[model samples]
Target: MSTASDYLSRLISFDSVSRNSNEPVSDCVAAWLQELNFEVERTTYVDPRGVRKCNLLARRDPIAAQEQTLASGTGGLAYFCHTDTVTADRWTGPGGNPFHAVFENGRIYGRGACDMKGSLAAMLDAAQSISLADQMRPLWIVCTADEEVGFEGAQYLVDHSAAFRDLASLDPVSIIGEPTRLSVIHAHKGIVGMRIRSQGKAAHSSTDMGINANVAMVPMLQTLLEIDEQCRTDETLRNDAFDPPTLTWNFGVSDEMKTVNIVPDHCTAWASMRTMPGVDGREIVERVRRRAEELGLSFDLYSGGDPMHTDRDAPFVKELCELAEPYIGANEPHAVCYATDGCVLGELNRRIVCGPGGIAQAHTSDEFIEIEQLENGVRFYQDAIRHWCC
Candidate 1:
């Protein structure tokens, strides 16, 4: 079997930036899996704007396209990992070109090296080694696209004809291979994208006849801060596994009035809220809207994902933790503040997040994955597949 570290080096060299199409990387992975005797099914996805992307679903033998058989008593398993990475910005030092693979100081440096191409490579290489082995439940590996955008790739695959109605393991135990530093992730926060518009009367600043939209933003920001604080102190809602257990609100993009002399008629701000499980994101949004209406400021709060979690003591969770102890050392499973493809995949299966690399290294310059982490990841996944599938 090819070592995951060597496979990762090649994945780092592919340059599958989120802005750039992932067809090349997807094609490369499809070719490798097929060579290992996997039957590949490619799903073509078109964005609302007509942009097309690809999702590859590869499976092993003794299963037909219309087969619905799953290993009885012990179900099937799905391995998911995204091939796309965020655009590498111009940075000084080793990150000048994130596409160029660099292996030094016991780490691998590249654009998608840690944010997840490394995990993808490790999963792919490991899957290839065991694709055709006789097993109880079939193994399914999904290679998705547009994860950097909105998880379009994974979402499409789950709802696609092949995943829901046709595949053998209809509701497999889904594992998202993100950079979790080899931690077993049973729960994480969910995101809600929102936009609020503050309205005002337009007039010359000198005339003092205009309602300043900029002035209106102050109270909105304050209210958001208050909400954030509430999220921090709410005891019943907090999960100690997470450092802070509550909804986190952060500003996104905003549209402001330009000239200081003119009081603009509209001031728009985009914000997002990441909520913990059991928090009613939609209700919070309605409350924000009510507050805006009471203040007489035109505002809109659109609700997003409330947050999702899996019982830490679930059988699958227990089995996975047991499988990883030998490979990853005393495993400490926990929840995180970030979101992953697990949110969407949860709809189809019992899902968990586990992989190599620290979350701190993701989305940063000089992003990398430790060589030891990759090796451990390889072993953990191998064991999981054997324990569950074989």
Candidate 2:
């Protein structure tokens, strides 16, 4: 098998779901990079549920070896990919088993195949063609954990990784390989999720002593709808760069009472929206929070991050766009609705979300990456490595 296919098959075999320990995947990646003589560093942390998550960073820095610092968008090139896959309980791909990766009809079927083990495989295969002696600058490969969850791995690395800090110093071009279909991405939306709760005394449904907290969410839901509509119509609140050009707001409330006869005391509703780069996410959030407080509801922010925006006209973007011409052919750097680790690694000056495969295939019951895209991805990454590292 080709190195990319071999590495991809091996990677997909590991059930590195976000909720489980990623040590096995990390171990294999570390070993593979080490075989290429790259300096490997690991940052390990336990998630809230005590799952052992590990982030791996490997780099080949010829200048640093001689007591100097060098960096790549290809300063030195750093390819960031997440090791965690979403829960594959719904997987019904050609393999029948999510972890066994089935190859047929010029496609590889499995969990994380397109949503990004394929991209990681491409990076691994591409790196093999470039040795340390072939680089005047540096090359970086970062396999992070918990990206599918909340970018916790990238955030943890930002807070605890020394090597990451050094990479930031170069202001290197950072590419988050996030199923962008190999297009150069200069911007994307961010996530804003929160839970709102209301408290009331419980009593019999027929008795007045019981308070139905569910009634409190009526007005709050109204406020959210208003914001959603305004976002949809208000040019000032929307960015034309996005497809929907709105926050894409969503929320729901679940009834906790087992029986309708008993008065329900607890009610919780969650509303999540996206943040645009040029828009003020704070004001939008404040509007919802204010309504929740006025209605005597408890509001808590669980997930929130600013949209990533890198100048499309930047030299680094231009170079990538030019290089991607063979694939996308003069298509301007695009934007996506999804969020990525770039939300956490915002400090890196030139950041883009570019990778193989389509988001259309991700998180589906049957996830796969086309063999042609995978092979082209290998060539793309290899050329990028040469551009930034050599």
Candidate 3:
């Protein structure tokens, strides 16, 4: 009997931060789906910090023949959402707790209210409204963990889940519930995070016997700047759909000796790149690697995800656009600069990023979602489910 707002309030109450366990939220979602007669599957994995995170896959298959259907290549539609939110230490809302969902001024204020939990609530309500007898195919509701950190939960599902394996064979269609303001998103930039390190001999600063690793890092930093400049000015890498239409880099963190008097033997710079689709991330890394070699420094490519782009002309894209036009009006499909689990899910199936709320409201100090947008999202998902599932 819980409404979408009630469900969202419950979801936001859980502190499913990227660094913490998402099991609490996952458990709540599973219980809700069970009430709706869904056969839920929970996948648990231990993170690097040994916290147990979970991914929930709930399906509405009354006849219990989804496995065969999926194996035969007619996979059902899936609504994908991430359960984790970014950690917030600077909350300015009334309750002074990011986990406390506050309803005020026609908006819901809380952590994850706009970033994702809003869409999760809408999806749950939409599924609840669907009649099992009207369903022509299986319907899946997926909640993943660690999406704010990386696509860890999605990756785990892809690697280990039998349901995912079956769906991959069928090439299922997925709707990723990211905060896209109800606009259809068919493309997004990828991410590459790396660390550049320089090593040298350590000694007293006053003595001429030591080499400063910080000094050695200067040329490498310059190289990174030059590479960034090239990416910015290069027309070939530009995609007009994106706002900036060029690769962007952030050299955000640097580590060196604590004391000014001691000669630093090692310096490390942590940086990341946002790459356009069709551009080779490896080539970009190699460009930096070659420069590091020229400067006689060692580097490590830590982690990365490929860019995602579904063709706007795809059948599913057209159908979704048509289905959403009446509710959200006619908004052309677009690209975003931010990354999502769609970057990973797109590899297995046709994926579109569309949901309630705006990216501007996400992860902010006073994160909130307009109540109207939340209600519209619920209606849109209900109609979408009817269109795709029934």
**TM of each candidate vs. truth:** 0.85, 0.94, 0.93
Candidate 3: where are CA atoms >4 Å away? 64-72, 200-204, 207-211, 256-259, 294-296
True-structure RMSD for candidate 1: 3.4
Q: Residues 189-301, candidate 3, lDDT per residue (tens digit)?
A: 98888888888788998999998888878888887777777788878767777888777777743654678788888888767888777765567788888888888888788
RMSD of each: 3.4, 2.2, 2.2
What range of 10 consecutive residues in model 1 has the weakest lDDT sum?
62-71
* Model 2 lDDT per residue over 21-124, tens place: 99999999999998887899999999999888999988877744444443223267888999999999977788589999899999999899999999999989
- Please tell me which predicted candidate would have the highest lDDT against the true structure: 2
TM-score of 3: 0.93
Model 1: runs farther than 4 Å from truth? 48-50, 62-74, 92-95, 166-169, 199-219, 256-265, 292-306
- Model 3's number of clashes is 0
Which scores higher on TM-score, 1 or 3? Answer: 3
Candidate order by TM-score, highest to lowest? Answer: 2, 3, 1
Candidate 1, position 382, lDDT: 80
Q: lDDT of model 2 at residue 351? A: 92
lDDT of 1 by residue, 177-284 (tens): 898877789888878776777778899878978887656766777777776676667665465566566666676434465667887777776667777777645666
lDDT of 2 at 239: 88
